[model samples]
Target: MKKFIATLLAFGLVATLGACGAKESETTNPPAATGETGATDTTETTELQTIKVAATPVPHAEILNACVDMMAEKGYKLEVTEYSDYIIPNTAVEDGEEDANFFQHTPYLDQFNTDNGTHLVSVAKIHYEPMGIYPGKSASIEEVPDGGTVAVPNDVTNEARALQLLAAQGLIEIDPEAGLNATPKDITSNPKNLEFTELEAAMLPNTVEEFDLNVINSNFAMAAGLNPATDALASEGADSEGAQTYANVLVVKEGNEDNEAVKALIECLTSDETRAFIEETYGGAVVPVF
Candidate 1:
């Protein structure tokens, strides 16, 4: 079967009043009514609140950028700060330096919380970017010789995701019960005896040429101008176990998931406007779950 490069988008809220094709409700002002002082009763407009979010440069930051103006219209200033690596974004949220973050999936977040004892949690499922095995030195899967080196993400969850993708290609075999956290040690069979090299997920795209094949997360592939749909020798699919387990999420410190700004941000992110943006900007590379 031909594998797919998964795309992802988020889901939340009932409707939006402005932007991204979310139309405002039509209303007519009632004839002016005078109060005891013969003055019209007026409602005070709520002040705009600014919320900080951390994201990766490619689709995460780009996707969030599409919602900035729409968020502002909804009484929130959506400030997105871009980070190249995975660690700081979560740490920043844990330390209360960022209001929330976008760019990672639930499994990564769960592992980070367990590994670091941080209090981050996912509030909404956004999109899923399928991991893909992109060519480094080898041009195609069949061309990868025995003893080939495959660079993979070092982080526990992602590394397992990469290994699983490779296993699906019949390039390797791993212990079946190891599941999402499986690693190279779980490989029960290596038909080609491919060597695995672990690296931080962000570094794979920049250094892909140094290896035989690199398992790259779609977001980084996108940033490096590698479209997994076209460039990958093999890729994960939407219906794959990883996709159902790894939809990118909007993460926040556990206690603050219900903040007003966070709620509005969720509304804008999952709004029709954002769904359209994901579809147009990323094509099939960033599929919207909503």
Candidate 2:
């Protein structure tokens, strides 16, 4: 009977030891239910980098918004801030308040950098808005009376573009030597005796009807509900030098032009998808330069 009792005690001790050993094994190693090489319940997620950019309304912001999903797929969060005035965008980039800007063309950038002493450089040529001659009081260029009032952009380069466009249309003649810098004073002849009244580019659209004719930038025209392709009397051709000279660009502080985020944004803006969006959305108003 003592031997039997010893046997029972021995079995009990063995069973208890087995249970403890099983528990310890479970505590040290866990089964990876996820089925990865090493099973772990702990999960880690990657965060996206944020790229802040400044842009004008119309095509720049519209174009950038379309690329948000593309940027995310490439692991970046694109944030755009809209500005009405041109100065703030470049200054914002120069002051480090923005990663980049997408509004002004390289010519405007060169002028801004020279005037404000800002160090901004273009990373990519995105698109160009052809300057269009939108009729106001005059139903057509031919209907304009002698000394008809014309509204033109006050900015230097744009004013020259306006004059060049008028000259090209045979409304007036300007010195060929003046080139892109032609102004009202550079007119070599005036067939209609048209008088130019200079105003801020953005304001031309608002008071368009008050003048006989208004030379408006494509962006401002579109913002005021005018389609350049259908509404304007005339605009730049796709093969025009304006395509290169006035093409809107992705710009950044000179030193940051080559940064990874800026490069990514450039890639997205110049992508085939972006080109398709521009062609379909703006028609001929905005042309992709890339």
Candidate 3:
């Protein structure tokens, strides 16, 4: 009877120890996951977009440079490529090699698109650089000798602007129908009987001294160390229709007008800060139209 009780007690002790071991295993080792795979939830990070623009070296690139930090703050990068000629910038944008361009006005852009068969559009009109009649051999309009030559830009849009400036100064009269697309053929009356020399817009500055007076684009005039606000014998007034019509604009490919990067650029360009910069930098040679 005593042996039987001791054996039973030993069996009970073994079972208790086994149960405790099983409990500890459950607490420490846990059950192996059955037919289940672990998964990690992750989010993708998006990279910022870069905007590339073609621009003239003067006020356009300089103005874009000022907006670089502002764009970066808004999570974008602005890359400005300087272009000396007018043709390549529009072509670059049309070909998608550049995101936008900033060297031309609406009329010039319209003419370019029509002539090149490219679908480019303006996103914003930023500023205007008045077309000025700068004296070369002649100091004033009154001093221009009869039949003296007056140089003008050979391009269609700029030639019209030059004619308009001449008309404004009473040196000549343009047909009312010629409007912004006028040429020498559109001239109705020439009081001075001045001869017109049509040359490339960029060449006007260099040839200014050769002609009695040269109609100079403000950018080229500034590049030649002439101030349109001061040195010009006659310039388009701020309130003039020409000033409103010839304001330089931000341009992009037609379908990309609403692109986020382009939108950001337009915002930066038209901001009050940019306006102030134009006023301070060019000293009214370039007037903010935004």
By TM-score, who's the top model here?
2
Q: Is candidate 1 or candidate 3 better by TM-score?
A: 1
Put down candidate 1 lDDT per residue, 1-290, tens digits, no spaces.
12322221112222231343433222334335466566565666687789999999989999899999999898888999999999999999999999999999988988889999999989998888988999989988899999999999999999999999999999998899998989999999998989999999999999988999999999999999999788888888889999889999999998998999999999988999999999898878888997
Q: Looking at candidate 3, what is the lDDT of residue 192?
A: 75
Question: Compared with the true structure, what per-residue lDDT tens digits does model 2 show for residues 153-213?
Answer: 9988888889888888899998989888888889989988888899998888999889998
Provide the clashing-pair count of each candidate structure.
Answer: 12, 1, 0
Q: Which stretches of candidate 2 lie over 4 Å from their true place?
A: 1-43
Model 1: residues with Cα > 4 Å off, grouped in runs:
1-47
Ranking the candidates on TM-score from highest down gives 2, 1, 3
Question: For residues 76-134, could you state the per-residue lDDT of candidate 3 as single tens digits?
Answer: 98999998779999999999999999999999999998899999999899999999999
CA lDDT of every candidate: 0.89, 0.88, 0.90
Q: Estimate candidate 1's alpha-carbon lDDT, on a 0 to 1 scale.
A: 0.89
The C-alpha TM-scores of every prediction are 0.83, 0.87, 0.82
- Model 1, 91: alpha-carbon shift in Å? 1.1
- What local lDDT score does residue 38 receive in model 2, on the 0 to 100 scale? 69
